[model samples]
Structures are given as structure tokens and as C-alpha cells.
Target: MTDVPAPPTPVTALLRAPRHRVSPRARLMWQVAALVEGAVAIGVLLLVDLAVDQVDLPWWGVVAAVAAVLAWVAVVPQWRYAVHRWEVTETAVHTQSGWWAQEQRIAPLSRIQTVDRAEGAVARVFGLATVTVTTASAAGALEIDGLDRARAQDLVAELTLKADAVEGDAT
Candidate 1:
């Protein structure tokens, strides 16, 4: 006789959605970046199709790839802009991020191990940065991307000070 599968455990949702949306300029930043990425992807595909003599890549296949790129460039950034948000309270840092697969995270100040900011070439050009909050949790670090550059700097400094004030790091 086969063993029966265990029932899935029900989990309570503890955190509410964060209060603040990212900078409005974030949408333009995301759109530009996506366009560059899509162009590179299509260029690479064309190169591969040209280089491979054994395979005659059909016209429909090329058309489909370009269509997919255009759709992603048009859609994903707007979706992500709508979904992404972040806030920091005295107790915790809350964030919601991603487009297709979203994540909502809350990291307690006491559990915070580090706070850092990052800016890619594209992001820097757009005057945007990402803030990462490292916490002593199994779920991993929480990141809030596409924040205003100065705002990100302020967040990093504020989190560092607040996290330092908390007693024991629950690590």
C-alpha cells in the first residue's frame, strides 16, 4: 500500500502591504533598461541564426522571438512598477517586489545584519539605486529596487543607525 501525501499547512499572513511606492521615475528607468536588454537578446539570436549553417531558422521563429521581446519590453516594467513598493518603520523594513512572481518581505530592525545600496550602469544613468537589507533570516535578504539615488543613500544611513540601536541580533 502507498503512503498518503501529507496535508499542506495553512499559514497566516502577518504583514500588510507596504505604504510607499518607488520613485515615479523608476518606470522610465525600467523601460529603458528593458529595451536595451531586448535589443541585445534579439541581436544575439540573429547572430546565432546566421552563424549556424546546419539549421535554417524559419522566418516565423525570428518573428516570434522579436514579438516576445517587444511584449516583455512593453509589459514587465509597467507590471513591476505597479507591484514594487517599500517602507521602513521604527520596527521593520517592509518591501514588495517583482512582476510575474512577487514577494512581500518584512525584516525586523533587530535582525538586520547589514544595509547596502547598489547602482548599475543603467540605474546610475537614470539616477536610481537599489537598497538591500540583510537580515538574519532563513528567507534571505530583502531588496527594494529602483529607488531615487539620494533616497537610497538616506535609507541606507537610516537603517544602519536604527539597526545598530537594536539590542541583540537574533542571528
Candidate 2:
């Protein structure tokens, strides 16, 4: 009997965010930065291993490696942590992200000061873009990176139109 491959896992509604989000350029940039950082970390660990070997091999070194590995149990999974999760509710945009200290941000469309998108080399290759939304709040800016450029522009236009419409209704 021919074995059929399992169907791909279906994405449930709850697991999905809005259709629009930050640009792909931004996501690519962040991902590239992460890869570079990970490489550097491995290099540092190698250096540390060499240096530690030159010194007396403390029993703690073994314990330290074990401990460090254990500690990474927490840090590693966080790399995939949702850096940006957003949804356009009727009233506002809600975002949630946190590796250690969790944070959630909400920005009403009316308060959006600017909407912009960026593209980079990776974005060019992948046809991705990033969208950033600034608000009156000094500490908060909404960025949705790693999106299709056309999609990003469409989203920006939609948000701007919505903001304008809301303003018109308020008057």
C-alpha cells in the first residue's frame, strides 16, 4: 500500500494574527542580526573554553558548563518568542511581546502619528517589507516587520484611511 504523507498542519484562527503587519525588511534585518549574534556567542563560548582550559580546570568548570547549559534552557526558546503580535480590534491595535518581562501595547488608530515601511537587501531578495507606526506616547511605537512590501503599503493606507475616517466621525 502506498503511504500518503500527513497533511500539513492547519493554522487555526487563534494562532493567526491580522492579515497585515510590519514589513518583511524589518523581520529580515532582525533575523540577520540574530544569526550574527548567535555566531558571535558561539565564538565567545569557544574562546571561553580555551581560556578555561589554560587555567586550572575547576570542578566548577564542569559544573559551570552544566549550569550554563541549564540556564540556556530558558534563554534559547525565547529566541522564537513572539517579538511582535498584533491585531486590529474595533477600537485599537493590540501588541504583545516579552522574553523575560512581558509587555503588551495598545495604540488607537487616532493616536497614530506616523506609518512607514522599510526595505533592505534581504527584503529585496525576499520581497518583504516592514511597517512602523509611531504614536504620541514617547515610549511606545508599533512596528510590524517581515511583511510583503505591497501588503505593507496597503496596510499603511488602510490604517491612514481608518484614522482619517475616525477623525471625520468625531467631528
| lDDT of candidates 1 onward, in order | 0.89, 0.63
Residues 98-135, candidate 2: write the lDDT tens digits: 54675667778778777788876666677777678788
lDDT of 1 by residue, 74-162 (tens): 88889999999999998989899989899988888999998999999989988999998988898999999999999999999999999
Best by lDDT: 1
lDDT (Cα, 0-100) at 141 in candidate 2: 81
Q: What TM-score would every model get versus the actual structure?
A: 0.88, 0.55
Model 1 misplaced stretches (Cα beyond 4 Å): 1-14
Q: Top model by TM-score, which number?
A: 1
TM-score of 2: 0.55
